[model samples]
Target: MTILFRLGTAREAFDVSMTRVRGGTGTTGPPPPGRRPERRGHLRRIRADRVLLLVAAPALAYFLFFHYGALFGNVLAFQDYVPFLGVSGSQWVGLAHFERMVTDPLFWNAVKNTLLIAALQLVFFFPAPLALALLLNSIVGDTVRRFVQSVVYLPHFLSWVIVVALFQQVLGGAGVVNGWLSTLGLGGISVIGNPDAYGPLVIAQLIWKECGWATIIFLAALSQVDEQQYEAAALDGAGYWRRLWHVTLPAIRPVIVLLLVLRLGEFLSIGFEQFFLQRPSVGPETGEVLETFVYYTGFANGDFGYAAAVGLFKGVIGVVLIYAANKVAHRLGEQGVYKA
Candidate 1:
């Protein structure tokens, strides 16, 4: 009560002093605008940081030339896009392709597969990295931890083609597992090419390849948690799980929510390379995703306009999902990927 009273009294004194100063200066409103000098100062700072700006030039150019530059090509979505005619020359038939997309059964199938894979990933793959990070954090030996991290992180550097082939060699119908089972007079189980097992298989592959790399962020967050808090919790007779639940998780909750929001933004983009490679084996019915659907429709079927419409639609949904997820994160008192 005393602390609150003192703070209130100090605030009142400051406000009164400010009002007197303003009245004496004959200023009845806010102070004069400082924006012009602020802008000059900002420009001067940028000029001083010219070398640093030079270093960022390549990345700035890459985004400008690729991402923002490509945005103009979304104009193809509303046009009957033709390679020979080009974007400006193409006939503009607004929303026709969008209507076609709504009526297209194949497009709906792709949507279904994309959502299923995304849900599977959210449920199974999302937490795998956090769990692995916790397990790795519990390890006492530096040598063992470094070795395990190196081994796990190596897969993330490998291309999707190599990863898929590695999985096939180990888990496919005629692979090591089936071969061993056959030798033991046990029946072999089909896995790689099976549509029914596609969801679980893809989830497994994603976990194996990306889980370790994903742990990097969580590990960094864990490193920032104060050791004193853990010690205090332990002194209070809290067990490992109890301490983790109370202290560790709260410290890292912001990082987790940030990653979750970012992940939700790209929820439907479950990767084209992996699904495209496996699509032939599992058949399009089970493996088609938005990216691959866009690829096949535009390149294979020569429906460039329709494909662009689908791509634009996907991009819009991604933006909306990110915005909604960020809002939810804000409501839950997390900063998420962006500020409200």
Candidate 2:
């Protein structure tokens, strides 16, 4: 009887210890007051965010139906696609379209122009926003900075047609710049339709339209930088340029690198509307890009299969570029578009 009582006491002690460890009575109980169980907490969060999810539903549906659904059309790249025959009746040509694309001189020309424009954009246009952001950040007064920002950002909202017209009015042979030059007895310079100047003109237009918008991102990044770092650098006898080089640039280097990687991923897509509108002025030799090339090949010539093949190739290249860039980002110890 004594041994049985001892064993019963030990069993009771063990149950009490377990109850304490579990922060409950016996084996289980309701969670402590003001605290929710894990599953309940997750459900509560989902309920709280339902409004936001509802608001985003339309956009999500549009992408699902339009963007992702259109991916199925890529099979046309491998077939001799005929509108009358439909996808189901289309003759499968295997790699014929791809083989033709590989040997096409026009496609190579488009590629060359695309690469040239992309390089120019990387060298000149990419740095404009950063420089502008730095200038805006240096302003001491909030009112002045905001006013300047508003003025610069206005162009971004203008349509590409309006922007192109504005450029023509400002820089065309008979426009303001030429009229001023003619009054000064100087020869009027041709810029709008000049083949040699087409690349620079497009880059200039892009800078005017988008540079300010891009600056907003850099400015936001700059705002997150602690002012104390700049003050400390100044105290160490570092001048304006030195502080910028050591502190400001380093603070935003990650954003710059991230943008660069993203930029490279879309290197071949140098805007369709801009190039299509300007192509007539400079001719196809100078103005043709992959976007325009695809449009002309597909819609204009009704060679859908060839165009689809070219588009598929471009997409594959973009994917490769993104993967390579993300890998480089990981190597540099930065979080890229996605986690390593």
lDDT values, one for every candidate: 0.83, 0.82
Candidate 2, run of 10 with poorest lDDT? 1-10
Query: Candidate 1, residues 282-303: lDDT per residue as tens digits?
Result: 9889989998999999999999
Estimate the overall C-alpha local distance difference test score of candidate 1.
Answer: 0.83
Those runs of model 2 whose alpha carbons end farther than 4 Å from true positions after fitting are 1-61, 327-340
lDDT of 2 at 300: 92
All candidates' TM-scores? 0.80, 0.80
